[model samples]
Target chain A: MAKYLLLKHYRGAPDPVNSTPMDQWTPDEVTTHIQYMNEFADRLKETGEFVDGQALAPEGEWVRYDGPGSPPVTDGPFPETKDLIAGWMVIDVENRQRAVELAGELSAAPGAGGRPIHEWLELRPFLSQAPETAE
Target chain B: MDERLLRSLIPDTLRILIRRGADFASAEDAVQEALLLALHRWPKDPPRDAKGWLISTAWHRFLDAARSEQARRRREELVLAEPPPGPASGKDDSLQLYLLCAHPVLTQSSAVALTLRAVGGLTTAQIAEAYMVPESTMAQRISRAKRKLAEAHFTEPGDLSTVLRVLYLIFNEGYSGEVDLVAEAIRLARELTKLSDHPEVHGLLALMLLTEARRPARTAEDGRLISLAEQDRSLWSTTRIAEGVNILQRALAQDSLGEFQAQAAIAALHADAQAPEETDWEQILQWYDELVSQTESPIAKLNRAVALGHAHDPASGLAALAQLDASLPRHTAASAYLHELNGDFATASRLYSLAAQKASNLPERHHLIRQAARLSGTDANGPWPGSGE
Candidate 1:
């Protein structure tokens, strides 16, 4: 099986079909959205497809080594222009088609009027160490 | 006791418990407990009869567990089977374990996990580490697999082919990392040979051995894939190749040819070659033909087209390729190679780039990118010749 990552973006991606900001959404709608995501992951777990998943706190810093002896440098929690990862789910699936299908289902999570989000998700494959076959 | 030898006793011990009417799940739990005790206790003072010790301990464990859980009172009725066990029951026990582990009700992944767990006798954590998955996820998977098996009456023996297919799947999916999963697969397949005399079993083992022999030269130190033709011939393992060829010859002599035997035959031919130029593509092509005839597999047909290209001419290969769907996983790559062979480097370059873009794995993508660069008359490692930005 191949592993795939479904990445949710706080910024940087092009506008999705339903482009309503999540903060503008009603509390009930946000609850519905979270419930849908949890159920989706639970279903994948039952199907033996889920690997690991977690939503990240939006507040984060970019750090780098200034030099061997200097304190590590830190940037803002998140600037408007900086690309931020909102959350991610990793799944192990039979093929790319299955990964795509699961990603599409996840993208259907409820949004601002409790309607489908249709949010653009960045689906990336995990680079595998193992090669299954020669021919 | 050697852990491998101790593990070898598990299938029979588990089988005896099962035959005495323990349900699959609890029996497995009991066997696992017994194994843990053995691992903890055996090294200091080894048992005189390892299998007997395990069976007795697991049986008592199952009884204790059954007694403690009074709500499921029906288990009390499952006292034991009346018939006396026979001498040759050992082989049948392991074979039955193989069949049950590869039950048709389970998906391929579940089958692999169950086979490694019940037969290979690996811990869930060990399996998780081996496959590079989280332990909780693997625990859930194994439980789900067991639940699926319970729904299907959990682990009744089936046909040998199903087990052979599972072993083949494991062999293909393996690579060395924390646990050398390929070696584990090879070890399990070797163990399976004693349990069944099926030619396909030997064929599958031979196929794995032959393929594994080339692994040393298959990839560069920097993790770049080296194509078979580009590989250093001196690096291939001759001992494994010899063993594989010997096994294939014996299987072929049985005169019951299957798809795996055909595949093994092709692998044997490739192993026989001392150099890229010495490969007998014609014979390889014929074996692919045999494989195709046996299974009507599209992959086999695609491989045959490649062999056709090398054996006859690129034109013949292209003609054959035209009959197959272009959407097949390696179709574009195969087409690119044939195009390059037929002196259409421009088209070959374009197809190679496309194939690289579509590659599912990193090594293959890198290899395809290199091919694209090669045909476009450029070096892969440096900047483009005429463009400086």
Candidate 2:
């Protein structure tokens, strides 16, 4: 089995086809979206595919070490200006095709007006344990 | 309790049982049962003769199993059919087992799994965990492989090259979960040498040993790939290097040269050097030339170019690489290295990033991206502060 990371972006991605802001949606709609995501994770766990899922706070600051014994420098929490990561779910599945199929389902999570979000989720494969016979 | 020693005896004992009268499947099951019994009993009461003990125990297990399944009349016939220990056969049955598992009808994956179980003496659960497959799946694969081996009507021994290929694949998988495949491959290769004194068998063992000796130096503390030129020589295992070189010399004395021998020769040169600058790239390039001609493998050719770059001019190396298909996995990486050597950091950095994107493994991708960052004058000593790297 191979592992894949399903990334939901807060920004940086090209505007998703269904560009409805979560805050603008009805409270019930937001609840539905959250439930769909939770259900997806639960289903993956049942299949022995779920590895982990985590959400990130939108406000993030970039930091760098100045030098030894020096205070580190930090940048702004520019949530709106830069592409921010929303959250990610890691799954261990059979193959790339299966990973894509799951990603498609995730993208179809309900949104405003109870319609599919069509959000573009980034699907990245985890570099597996190196197989024999290196090409 | 010297489980490895017990494991080594597994195939030989199984073969002995089969030769006496036991069917292959029954014999295998008996051997497995004997091994489990050994694991439980050996530590408390070690066997004076492990192989003999296993053989007798497996034979008894086989008899018991056969008797339980059939009538008393058939059990008596099985007892009568059993052969007493006699002078060893000129052709070792263990060798036959190798040939059987390496049968060409089986795919590489199946052959590897079968050889690990029947020949290398790994348990199905251990093999499954190593390959990240379910135990049931690996069990099925091995059974299917054995069935395929049984069905193939090989009038003579199967291809020795196929056996060597499977062993090499197992070695390359390295250690994960319960199985240390590198050690397993080395153990199997050593067994192969005992059964058949073939030069290529020695060559393959030597190659694996020489390469594995340098494994400790192949990665940084942070798990990034360390190029040969940068690795600390002190970390290389001298004992394994000596053994590998000794084996290679003996194989060379036989004068039946093969691709594995040539590859080992290259590895030996790398191992022999005190420092990267002391490497005999000229001799390495010559060995790679022999390797390219013998195997006609693109990976060998790509490596040959890298050796060419170290031995001669970067331009010459680039010229050789240009002849290769660009779509090849390592082509961009090779080009980037050669370009970097030629002092074209601009192109090198770009190509390094491109190679990073195309890399199949995390360490390799990180290494490539680090190379790009270094070339582009970006501070890479700090932790990766962004998502991509």
Candidate 3:
């Protein structure tokens, strides 16, 4: 089996089929969208596909090492320009096809007016343990 | 009293309890309690009918558990309607039990732990020891898996591939503490052979046997991985190799070739060679061709590239490698080797160092680093003092 990272981006991804943001949606629509995401995770847990999922905080900073015994340098928590990761769902699945199928479903989480978001999610494969027979 | 025989009877007894109205969790508990009782009592007074004894004891334990529950009214009704325990559907129940434990609803690790306990008939302590987990942790994992599948009704037969995958995972876990997972997997596969005559089951057993035969030579004294060509063939287990070959031959003769059978054929070719130079690379390439056609796995393609390097010229191997995605793990290492074979030592050295940087395991990373150093005419422990600025 292989693991995949289903990444949801806050800004980098293309526009969704349903373009309205969650904050602009009606309260009921927002509730429905949240419920949809929760239900999707629950179903994945039942299917033994879910490893973990979480909504990331919007604020983040970049840090880099300078040298030995040197204080690390930090960059701004650029919320406007940087390609921010909204959150991710990590899944262990039977194959890449299954991971894609699951990502497609996650991308369909309800958006404005409780319509399918049809968001673009970046599906990335996790590098697995090296095969034993490899030299 | 035969411990293995008693353990083998566990699934049958558990099925009897479930059919007689015990819930899955309670049935498992009852079976476990009955087994513990047998361990203590059977030595002093062995029973003539071990299966019957286990079934009866487990049934009583199930009833006791139900009676102790708060829903006494429902418990009494179930007890009244419950039929006397009879011999379970024998082979069918055992096979179904295997599928249930390996249910898709359970995680791989959970399925493995459950299979070792519920179907393989090993104790929780034994399974925990084998996996090198605390008993409580293994217990929680098994219980969580059981709960996840509690509502799963087996209207359709369990998938054979899933069961095989779980068993293969077990075999891959190797040995730990007092338990040998490899031996345990072989035992479970042998049991599976009795329950179902699926060729793939036999194929799996053969594959495990063949690969395990090389375990003694798989690692060097310092725990570094040894490539097959560099392994000391004298250290290989002849007995295991013979058995594996015999099983593989029987499977291949069936004319219903599957992926595992093809893989076993490749392993068999390696075991057949007396020395690395004598290896039948051409025959191995044929098996790889079959494997690639049967399963379009990238891993298979990577391996085929390695075989191509040996079967043909290095240029041909590099050409084949070019067809695959360079992003695949170990792609650089394979490229480096082909370059080295073609006398492009500088490029090979660079690629080896790049591969070392990306290596996932310490042993493999060290091996790649050494390869890079040797190609660069530097000492493995450290670079030569005047080698670089």
User: What are the models' TM-scores?
Assistant: 0.70, 0.72, 0.66
lDDT per residue as tens, model 3, A1-135: 899998888677787788753433443554456566778888999999998776554457889998999999999767576776767889999999999999898888876567788888899999989999997
Give per-residue CA lDDT, model 2, range B1-389, as digits (tens). 98798888888788878778676666877887788888889999999988999899989998889979786557767656545545667356677778778888889999999888777777788899999888999989988777776566565668899999999999999875677899999999988888788899999999999999999999855455788888988999999999999999999999988999999999999999999889999999999999989989999999899889989989999999999999788899999999999998877877876776567665676577667766754322222212321
TM-score of 1: 0.70
| Native-interface RMSD of candidate 1 | 21.2
Ranking by TM-score: 2, 1, 3
Residue A61 CA displacement from its true place in model 1, Å: 32
Evaluation by DockQ, superior candidate among 1 and 3: 1
Clashes of each: 0, 0, 0
Q: Candidate 1 lDDT, tens digit per residue, B123-201? A: 6777788777888998788888888887886445576888888888777766745556677788888988877778998
Error of 1 at B305 (Å): 0.5
Q: Name model 1 segments beyond 4 Å from true.
A: A1-135, B36-57, B80-88, B154-157, B378-389
Which 10-residue span in candidate 2 chain A carries the lowest summed lDDT? Answer: A21-30
Q: Which candidate has the highest lDDT of all? A: 2
Winning candidate number (TM-score): 2
Clashing pairs in 3: none
User: Among all windows of ten consecutive residues in candidate 1 chain B, which has the lowest summed lDDT?
Assistant: B380-389
Ranking by lDDT: 2, 3, 1
lDDT of 3 by residue, B1-389 (tens): 78888887888788877777776777888898899899889999999999999999988888787877747567867655545555767678778789888888778999999898887778888898887778999999989888888666555556888999999999988874677889889889888878877778888888898899999999865455677878999999999899989988888888988888899899999999999999999999999999999999898998899899989988888999999999798998899888998898877877776775556554565566556655753322221111000
Model 3 misplacement above 4 A: A1-135, B1-6, B19-21, B36-57, B70-73, B76-88, B132-134, B366-389
